[model samples]
Target chain A: MSQENTAAKAAPGVEKKEKPERDIHNLGSSFIFKPNVIDDIHVKAELGRYRMRGFSLFKKIPHFDDLTFLPGTLTRFVIEGYREKCETKTILGPRAKRPMELDIPVYITGMSFGALSYEAKTALARGATMAGSATCSGEGGMIPDERRYSEKWFYQLIQSRYGFNPHHARLADAIEFFIGQGCKVGMGGHLMGQKVTDQVAEMRSLPAGIDQRSPARHPDWLGPDDLALKVEEVREATNWEIPIQLKLGAARVYDDVRMAAKCEPDCIYIDGMEGGTGAGPHLATEDTGVPGIAAIRQARKALDDVGKTGEISLIYAGGIRNGADLAKAIALGADAVAIGHAALIALNCNKDIEEADFPNEMGVEAGYCYHCHTGRCPVGVTTQDPQLRKRLNPDEAAERVYNFLHTLAVECQLFARACAKTNVHSLEPEDLAALTMEASSMAQVPMAGSQHTVGRPDMTRY
Target chain B: MAELESRDSHDMGMHDEQLAGRTQQIFFKPSAEENFTYPGAYEVDFDKETEFDAADMSNKDVNLKIRDLMSQGYGSITIRNPGAKHSLGVCILNRLQLTFDGSLGYFGCGLIDGPNVHIKGRVGWSCAENMMAGTVVIEKNAGSTFGAALRGGDLVCKGDVGSRSGIDMKGGTIIVGGKTGMNSGFMMQRGRMVILGDAGQNLGDSMYDGTIYIAGKYESLGVDAVESEMTQTDIDWLEKKLSIYGLKAPNGVENVRKIVSGKKLWNYDNLEPSEKKLIL
Candidate 1:
């Protein structure tokens, strides 16, 4: 078959004929493909996975504007190569007043241990720690192996309530009580039986091969008040030493944040509907939860209304890709941001193992194929296959994580410089303007300048 | 309207007689006194087609009224399309106290320990769906899979329960007055399902360590249930049970087909031998 015909048939309509065929490598397949000939093949954003054939066309779009950095003005200047350019040290502990403590603002978002191999969890913890950031354990419990790499670790107390590790008292820096994750709010997680290795099966207390069904609601506590009590129980169990944060998907976030505030939690991190998952049910990932930008605004309002604004730090996650998002979130009153799928990419997941035709033998195009719930992750990050996992070298992956964190920090500094600000927190609505009118209104920030200023921002809230 | 329905000759003669028999058999006569009594107890008066508006009821009064309502033994008081825009929020009434008063029969929600219950009448899926004391019985044969995950309590069906009655009962007894469609005790761990009539296909399919006694013939017994030794103790238990249900034990009580297995479906770690025998 002609290469063009084969490419067309491989993922119909997603790719078009190109002139200067570029050499493309994946699992076992090798082919020459031209980027431009493929209609609309301008995807330049090199972050995130592109799983289904449907999104490959968008992959052709370019991401960076020639590594654009913010220009330094007299007000704010960039200080590089100085012995003391800026102190990079941060203190994170569970007992601090700000309950949800973290070494760096960047943290590992929730990705189930069951969805990932033991090595993946270890690598994440190891990588996150190496990067001076914290890693949050997903619904899965605090595995002993993962504990070794834990310096600043957040344990997700999922609704499933699996893996109540005794050392959770000691190893955990903070207890993140997950009310509803953004990807699947008002739903339970479905860990297919095939993924349940003997170890995973024992940890989750389910049969080795029977599909595990997390209850739709919590087994013990039923409502917000009950969750408050459970939070108290954890506090007492940990001798009032640990700070508790409540994490919930951003759907009906108005009420959710209100309830979280009522619970008197130290931090409320909202995961926008766009949150990434190693593998969520198709319906949930595609259609559930509110977008992140709006969630942050709602959460901020909720906390402000209760006069608990600074008392509980607000963090937002879901589909956050670049420093611009970081800037927008802070302007929306989010204290920090957490990332999941991005962290995985930094760990070098979804990469072609041997530089072959496809990303992996699974015919998964690349990053988008995070259907790890099937236990057949073409790349090692999301699978239990020891051989596949071997392809992922933790040390190298750890460096990548460190590099990604460093890059994100640099980008933050650049944005701060542009807005004539020093600390990220210093960037306010007045300093920055959104690109879109809708974004400007939703963010409660002004447009580019006074010329486009329509009304006092307080009068409108989308 | 309810009074008129109760007086209807056809409804009275057939349904009332059957209910009376069932009541005598299930409740151990001189039954528990009607414990609950309150105004606006039943939303739907037995004969009335229209249901009582749950909105009219304050949450405070819902439980109390439902408690009293269940005692009236209305055959099929349905909370039609619950969890809908115009449906009553879940209300539980403890053990339906009323028997076949006829009036087209009452006997709805019996022994509601606590569950948002909505009964579509002529109900027959184990009056309780894994009822831990809560019950919702239907006057008609529950199609099948009644008491599938019955945890506790009694779900007495007035009509034939179609197949797989008490399929995976952990605790509780489902006494089907008529017949069991099939696979009656599929994986019943710790419960007794007394089927009064013929049982359908693969009855007690691979049933592990539970007692399913069918008064009539069983079409097929599944992978687990082999014949078990029916001892004198078994006969004695059957006789006592049948007498309560107002039925004499089948002739030659000494000879009865019993299906038994020690295998447990849930805990695969524990597997025991199967002993099937006709004990005299």
Candidate 2:
């Protein structure tokens, strides 16, 4: 390290110190206002509006990695991984005459037809059906092909009611009343003008070539009392044969879940801040809703308080990536877990395929792309454009999705067997230890190598 | 600033050519197929009249009986004492003459495609919601959220209707013989609403695309909802619609104030450089 070499390797903003002991005019950097913060400010100042993007949270929070499962030893007996059966059967909305039954404990959450191209939507439906899982008809309504390929499907009755039809609703195995989602809570959905094609526009009954900002409130029902009637109306329309699930964003989970239970839905789904969206204000995604670890616990507690625990099922979605995350969610009391972004990833969202030039096309590297809002998805998962859509082969993508979903179930079973649980639903909170204090408090689990749980009145008596 | 403007697709390296029939197969094309096969398209005879008393039966029993009747080719059906049960006569996708002799509850006759329904008594909220092609006539007063998300056909209430009538209406016509509650036709996309009597506050608020004719006084206009000049064509249509429903506007049809969208909130116009689409 000669002085000349040091000067060449120094970053652009660095003030080269001539003397080793000199402290004059030397001020440390800001944690709040980093270089990225300045970059955000500069962009907003130029744009005059909140910047929009498609992805989940950009900032790190206490996540599943902080919770480690405690395998069995002398105190507990471990079920043999290779021979024994770890039942992955999951049932949602059991109160209905025909509950939504799944071979695995995981399903693909709704991601609307307008946000994703035809190939991507159908491929997802086919893959989930192969895995004996379910898929939802997100916001802008159902793609006919997606329905044809899917075995079990949920028709979402969103607040916007974009493309909602009773004829279509009757075709579903279940009905989901989408009140809100985790990524951008308290806001309606967003479909930029670029993605609102002629067909998509017709499906949603909106004008073409316009930024379709959906209404956040339901046009029919105004309050919980009204919602109760609305739910009854749907049940009657479905001949009381299918289950009805309420999907809400994770905010004030305990109170929200209690109110949701009062609505008399067969199932309640809470989406955490880790949920991804096709398009939304970037700030909303970063600063809205609680994490999954905390949301599930509060939701489960709320159901218990209302004495609707077994009568009503709880499903959690948001930031769920792998088998470990699935096991952790089930352990935290979620009967089933739903995934969105990870499913799209399996459909080749951010892949640097030979058909795509990620750096040149997306203005970012393949792994760093978060530009689904612009409808220029490099790997063809989100775009409606014909050329970009061609990049994703549905046959190959469907197989990949099935493989990924199959892998997730196996991995979750692995943990269940190691924890001396013969059934995936039997994974309990007692088997997990929190590595961080924030995680310990949020998940309500004891700290690693200690009997104390953070935020509890009796911290030492877990 | 000009150099930084990546407004068009070419700036972001997206292709401009519209590749036809290449990337997407049959399902992607708008003109290809409807995708879903509509269920319960039963054939029935109009002369085969049937009347059922639903006083002692639950809502399910009545609905199932209606299905059984429809499957047996009975088109002219009447139900006595519907008990104002919610979700009565829902998802009827065929043409039939249906009659409710008593007042109905919420979501009555919803999601019907082609049916001529007559309700002799007053109805609760959200009657005839999302009706594709049918005529739902309530002789008495109707509750709030009347004819919500209605797509096609006509929804007529001889008496007053509650708030948020025709909210998110995609198509069809809503005719209120008397006064209506506030925020009627909120966020309405496409449809025609005729208010014969007074309207509550915020009439036609934030409506995307629709025509609202208010014959009587209104409390106030909402965001992006502005009054427009009434044409002779509008007068003729109102006169015909009123005649068909056997209701008269207090004043003549020519005096009704026509309201439409101001077209101000449709587009923000500040497209991020990448949002500008050059690709079709």
| Model 1: per-residue Cα lDDT over A218-243, one tens digit each | 43345776566556544533435566
How well docked is model 1, in DockQ terms?
0.02
Residues B63-171, model 1: lDDT tens digits:
3344445545442333322221111222242323332211111112322343333333454222343345543444456655566556566566656776667765656
**TM-score evaluated only on chain B, model 1:** 0.54
Q: Which stretches of candidate 2 lie over 4 Å from their true place?
A: A1-18, A21-26, A460-462, B1-37, B271-280
List of clashing residue pairs for candidate 2: B6-B273
> What range of 10 consecutive residues in model 2 chain A has the weakest lDDT sum?
A15-24
- Global lDDT of each model? 0.56, 0.88
TM-score of 2: 0.90
Please name the candidate that would achieve the greatest lDDT relative to the true structure.
Answer: 2
Query: Best candidate per TM-score, number?
Result: 2
For the second chain, the TM-scores of the candidates in order are: 0.54, 0.84
